[model samples]
Target chain A: MLFSRPMIPIDILVYGIGLAGVAAQAAAGVLEAGRKPFDLFGVVIVALAAALGGGSLRDLLLDRTVFWIADQSYLITALTAGLVTFALVRFVRLPGKLFLLPDAVGLALFTVSGTQAALALGAPWLVASLMGVVTGVFGGIVRDVLCNEVPLVFSGELYATASWAGALLLIAMKASGATPGTSALAAGVLVLVIRLGAMRFGWRLPVFSARL
Target chain B: MLFSRPMIPIDILVYGIGLAGVAAQAAAGVLEAGRKPFDLFGVVIVALAAALGGGSLRDLLLDRTVFWIADQSYLITALTAGLVTFALVRFVRLPGKLFLLPDAVGLALFTVSGTQAALALGAPWLVASLMGVVTGVFGGIVRDVLCNEVPLVFSGELYATASWAGALLLIAMKASGATPGTSALAAGVLVLVIRLGAMRFGWRLPVFSARL
Candidate 1:
């Protein structure tokens, strides 16, 4: 029964990652002209980035098995998402204004995932939190780089801040005796809410030079 | 004595990776421009891909600390390599044939490095070998994509094959009690020899499909 309970959360993470990956890739692919479907290789690359990039970074930093490699589902999911996106691109117009919500969700999940991994490894809190932020954001950074754009991590908006807060909060809640799944859920929700609110409200960070 | 002995090999691996990274970056930066320094960002991106891309993919897949993040020297060396190569591009010209050697060598080292990481993580030998090949070739694939070209990996070359053979050999030797460093060195040499031999002899793989 305990083992079965864990599967519920893991499934949520898996399914969410797959759906978000499809949305992100479809959005990115629309950047391509509809005159041609992205070649299989390119589309899959985008999907993989959108899906696994963040979590992969987190796991590697925390020295844990990458979530995808442990179970083949992530790869198959990304592959399926890429194909479905490519096939359906002609019929859908992605909502440009709300793109950050899924990105935020992925980031939140990855951030918590990274924190959980680091804590499992018995790393210090600072290391755990930092790894979480890195995990949540690194994939998008990579995706942007591969796509020849500057990464979200470097640019404006509350992208990373939202994830960071959720991760830190998850760590705090667990330190105070909260259940793992409940803490993770709360953190994930925080990230999703912050990210969506930021996008919807036009929340912006200060200019690059202002902090100094 | 035991600690120092391990440290000796570790130092060698790090130094070798750094050198190979620099050489690979310089070569890629030049090839990227085909003998010109185009844009600052583009050259740097190519250099980063050449120097760090292989190892990054290896770490991501293996779920290990990214070698670059663990050691900032790799970044410094790559940046320097790209600048120096850009500055000297006007004064030096490499024969087209000579270029293939380092490309193959980079692939070889990357493969061995990846294979080693995978083995250390207790991956199955087959998976380790595949990871090795991925490490050796993925960087160039990334470079080509960023440079807006189809990857050499999917093109008509024995690039991945050389790395794959070298990795399998390394793993076989290691499993039989050969020291890891020695196995790695032999693999690198074998890959280099095979790759260069193919180029020098003008060997090509037979086309798979009858179509153009």
Candidate 2:
């Protein structure tokens, strides 16, 4: 009964958005992997991790069947996107920032979906918000980790913060009796705008190094 | 019926070994975190990840309840061990290699437990064997990744290889009708001996740099 939601039009739209988000993350993963001298297997592994790691963690924590495993479309989409990006990059000198916009879009979509999923499960407010942040940013963290680099989210400009803000807004809107569609749309837009604005304005969190 | 096994003496012994493995990984995590200038929270996070990451992943893949959440004893044990190591190291400069023996023991214990769990769930042979290796080494991988270093299991002296070898041996023994306890004991010893021997003899896998 966990995933027995009636597939209304809004649900279909959300599903499409989720697939797009997966594709975006997988493409970004391939780009990141290209920076290192990894083999084909390594590249695919990184791509899969980047695309599926966040949602998998969220589902596992919530004891839900993993989304990709429940529906293989997500897996196929990630793999196809990754392979295409890998092949494209080998031939063309694409700009490093080409993925920035799509990445932001993916972040917004994932945040909305993740928060909604947690709330639907009747999770506590704080846990729901954190799950949203995790789904929005953990993929990038996993990608960076696999590449043996510091997780970009931990030190980057307003990425997870943007996701968290939107998650909170989504919860607030829902509590204030907004329709689910309206709340989801508003929250997703907020996340996207904040992420894009942060990049454009070079906003950053304070970097602290504790001596202890 | 998943975890409905009778709590026989062997099960209790295995559970005790599992707890010891968790503690060992947690202590090793603290030692690694000491190298970085992380605060108390960061140290604890790293400790928990190193102690629980592997088993969590295995359980998630198999759709089983996460061990730490199902039993709080594992969480308490990891936290206590991490804090104790943290406190001890502040007063006394422990040798850098102090945790090696415990880490090896942990790898053996985790490999045996993980393989057994997966096989009980009726996972195919290859999947079950890989689950064992995942449980044996993924913690170290997560720890090194959080520290922004290449995974020690991927680059170090025959760590995951030893784990995989032991996992395969476990499966073969079980298939040949060996007693469960005997198979577990042999496999655990094999992993420990191979890991220790690799460390002492400087055994290593080929380090390849592919141009593609």
Q: Return the TM-score for each candidate structure.
A: 0.59, 0.60
Tens digits of lDDT, candidate 1, A1-212: 11112222457645666456445543443333222223344444555666667777676666556666564455566656556655554456544444455556666777777788789889998888888888777766766665555665676778888878898899999999999989988998898888888877867777667665
State iRMS for model 2: 6.1
Best by TM-score: 2
Off by over 4 Å in 2: A1-10, A205-212, B1-4, B7-56, B65-140, B146-148, B152-212
What is the DockQ of the complex in model 1? 0.10
**CA error at residue A212 for candidate 2, angstroms:** 9.9
Task: Please give the fraction of native interface contacts (Cα pairs under 8 Å between A and B) kept by each candidate.
Answer: 0.09, 0.13
Which ten-residue region of model 2 chain B has the weakest summed lDDT?
Answer: B1-10
The collision pairs in model 1 are none
Q: What number of backbone clashes does candidate 1 have, counting pairs of residues 3 or more apart or in separate chains?
A: 0
lDDT of 1 by residue, B1-212 (tens): 32222222466755675466457655675567553435867777787786678778877676566777776667777778777776766688755554465567667777787888787777667667867876776777677666765455543545666777899999999989998778988998888887787666755543222110
Candidates' chain B TM-scores in the order shown: 0.83, 0.93
lDDT of 1 at A201: 88
